[model samples]
Target: MSIRKRLSPEESRTAALEAARALLIETGPQSVTLKAVAGRIGRTHANLLHHFGSASGLQKALAKDLASSICAKIADAVIASRSGIGTPRDVVDLTFDAFDKEGAGALASWMLLSGNEDALDPIVDAIHDLVVELNEFGSEHLRDSTLALTLMALGDALLGGPLSASLELPRTAARDRAEAMLLGSIDQAGTLAPEG
Candidate 1:
């Protein structure tokens, strides 16, 4: 029999994480058993445990990986929103697009349902940065604007398609209204930022 090539600890961990991430996006967190991930990565479950210390460790690492990817997209959206290059509608559309395209909405739902609340920290931190940007831009009520925009975009990602089909509304009509309202609020607050 031929000897198998050895994988370094880092390579093994990365391979396992990539497998877990793909599985998470495809079947949700519920399906990410160590055995499944190990099989997907062509490693033994013990090998994974050796690297991760335990199944919980693997899940935690996977959650962190997923959150980081999702958070980066959100951060980019917030960066765009801060720039003032795009209108409010543009910001809203980009936010929803980022969530939907990444399947982040579903991934988040699964991770939270799986009792991995730690998964949300990175995304929360990213949003915090966005709020700070809005505050610096002269938003009178940073809390309200952040809450409204975030909830609106997330709702749109989760329900926009089905709602659009049921109402016979254009897929983007609701988003358009929400964006207009978001812009209206910002306008009412006034654009004191340099970009304006």
Candidate 2:
């Protein structure tokens, strides 16, 4: 009888990572474990060690993946707007939506496991890059990018809060409020503009 060869180290880690992400999204991050991740990917505990030196290592990789994915989505949403019509509001909405239960669970894990602000540095840099890409503001609008990031973070925090447990009505209401506030700010700024 021919014996089936086991997956290589890289393949095992890749599978484990993918499975961890899926489980994190579907069930919750608490569902993740060496045994569970291995089983989900049809591998054994020994196989997981080949990829991640330890549970902490796996957690670090997962945190990195979550940060990358979240920042990418936020960046795309920011860059997609050309109308400038409530763009900040759109960003607020999209950012909060990105923090759905799955994302929230992952974020919770990041806070508990990593808990280091340095771990969030990459994500902050990514948002800064996103701002530079989406904005064409001169010296006068210098503060706009900063403002946008702050407000967007606030919105993300709110939506990630326990008060935002429901995904449907609460999210819609928050988006609507954000849209109104953003539009109001834009309109007020336009009124204060000096005539050409």
Candidate 3:
């Protein structure tokens, strides 16, 4: 039998969350269970329970982890776009991918349907904090743009493929629309600025 390397509490928790995230992306949120995570990490269910208390708690921690990392990346993309090193499409793609490929949308819906509504607090709080942080970048319409972008991303994650196919549009139609919205917001912000 192979010996499992010891990990600190923080390291064990992080490893569990990372494994859960991978499982979420690979299978779906429904597979992100304490037993599965523990198995993946070579730990016991009791260990996961020690860290997270329950499956709901584990899911909440995973939500918080995803939100924090996604927001940081998006914030970097937004700042890079402002500095001409990135584009609005980068920000839009990141947002959409977080909801879609990263499985936040599916996980959020699962948590809600499972009646663990409070688990969404981390996601909501992260978005709010991200918006507040982005405001420092000085787009007057940042709040409205963030609101629109988030809803659009979430909706697209849920239905963009089938809906686009039904409408005879490309799968990326929603992403294109989101990019356009960001570009329009940037133009509008520029136009409304007072002359220096």
Candidate 4:
């Protein structure tokens, strides 16, 4: 006797999102299509439409999931950065690592929403909420400074600028250089405290 195969609605939704993510990473968002997602998951286009309504719906869901996942990592890294058990250099390093995972997703999602003002507003608002929550624990001055550095580094790396490659230097070397620069600035500003 031949066996029948079936997937629950939730399972199908999950599988579709997984396929969408794979496609996004493999060929960028331009290649994402409901037909492709369904085919990749051994389902029909009609079945995909039934679950997600439209290609855009699936893409939206994928973007939301990606944002949530990336934010979780950022939260973890931010906690480590706050402990003072590690230096600011360590914070910068972890921020870069977090961007490496979520940067592309955020960029793509923003680009998509930008062309659709209705979607753009809500997504940006959500991101702003996340950012506010994530940095609330740190001093406003330090939080702002850290966010500025993270954004600058992220932009530089994404743009492939000459100095951007420095972000990929050996971890120890990068940390030492960053720490030296940070401490040097503090000393120059007369903000450095004497050894306790």
Candidate 5:
């Protein structure tokens, strides 16, 4: 029989995360499993356990990975947008794009359906970081507006069809409407709707 190769602890953990991320991107978060990720990377379920403790651990790790990457992209976009190199909306667009194109939407939907409270922690932290970064860049004025747009974008990424139906807009145009709504609110002086 042929022998399998071995990996260091760091390499194994990284491989597990990569496998989980690929499974998430390809088949959505519902399909991710420690066994599946371990199998995908030619490792064992025990290896996953050693690295991640359990499936919940793996899911939390995966969620953190996705959220961190999305936040990093947002951070990069902010850096790129300095000196009016990009519009303020670019950050919103990038955030939405990350949620849509980078599997954050699927992760969010999965976490919500699974009632995974731990998963949301990373996303909330990332958003907080983004808000701080925006404020630091002199866009403190955009805080409320930015948070609203981010909610819309993230909500749309998962529920665009329903939102479109509710608004009588095409599925593809929900984002455009969201952007317009944000722009309209940009000139308004207020806090976030005074949460009830």
Candidate 6:
């Protein structure tokens, strides 16, 4: 005696992806299955399969979505930092939070371990595109800084808590180091810039 609400295909897909992301953040990457997403969205497994082709397809779509969303925010933060409206720590926190609180790190590692190595393409491509787009900022060390920041964020997401505890350091030790590195890179870049 229940009526199902009708949704367009795009709406359905978006809903499924949102549900999958929620599952990723709430439960972990291992819980982001087609069935679970479908259930979360009140759709059938066949519906999700139709939209995504398979579980791997769903994961790839989710990864692409997460990358696009996170990169856009990071890009905004980078722009703010360049305009002196934000600090390097803002960028560092966003990057680290994307990996940790947003579940990108866990999802990426799970995809790799599950043999869906190509699922990482979206993440890599997004980072590459972000760097390229931001290259107009004119920092020769931007790429290096990005690499260091991303690796540090990912590593911290994976082990910073336990490692920091074991080392008797604050939980934010890695984030602090990342902020320092970014600030140093910016200073060095400024010093090397040609005089106007």
Per-candidate TM-scores read 0.70, 0.63, 0.95, 0.63, 0.81, 0.97
Instruction: For candidate 2, write residues 1-196 as lDDT tens digits.
Output: 8554587767767778888878777877666677889878777777777677765566657766665676676666556544443366666655655555335435543546655344445445655665566555432342463455445444555443454555535635655666566566556655655667
List the candidate 3 regions with Cα displacement exceeding 4 Å.
Answer: 137-140, 194-196
> What RMSD does each model have against the real structure?
3.8, 5.2, 1.4, 5.9, 5.1, 1.1
Each candidate structure's count of clashing pairs: 0, 0, 0, 0, 0, 0
| TM-score-best of 5 and 6 | 6
lDDT of 5: 0.75
Write down the lDDT of every candidate, Cα atoms only. Answer: 0.70, 0.59, 0.94, 0.60, 0.75, 0.94
| Candidate 6 off by > 4 Å | 194-196
> Which residue runs does candidate 2 get wrong by more than 4 Å?
1-10, 83-90, 104-106, 109-125, 132-171, 180-196
Summarize candidate 6's per-residue lDDT along 75-147 as a digit string, tens digits.
9999999999988899999999999999999999999999996978999999999999998756669999999
Clashing pairs in 4: none
Per-residue lDDT for 27-134 in model 5, tens only? Answer: 888878888998899888887898888787888888788778877877776666656576546766887777777777778778777877677787778788777866
Candidate 1 local accuracy as lDDT?
A: 0.70
List the candidate 5 regions with Cα displacement exceeding 4 Å: 137-140, 165-168, 181-196
Worst 10 residues of 5 by lDDT: 186-195
Error of 1 at 140 (Å): 5.0
Give residue 165's error in model 1 in angstroms: 2.0
Tens-digit per-residue lDDT, 52-95, candidate 1:
88665777676566546654655565556758654566667666
lDDT of 4 by residue, 40-111 (tens): 988899999999887777777776666566555555655655564545565556555444443443445455
Model 6 residue pairs with clashes: none
The alpha-carbon lDDT assigned to residue 48 of candidate 1 equals 91
- Quote the positional error of residue 39 for candidate 3 in Å: 0.6
Worst 10 residues of 3 by lDDT: 134-143
Per-residue CA lDDT of model 3 for 1-196, tens digit only, reads 9999999999999999999999999999999999999999999999999999999999999999999999999999999998999999999999999999999999999999999979789998998998888786465588889989999999999999999999999999999999999899989977876678
Deviation in Å, model 1, residue 137 alpha carbon: 4.6
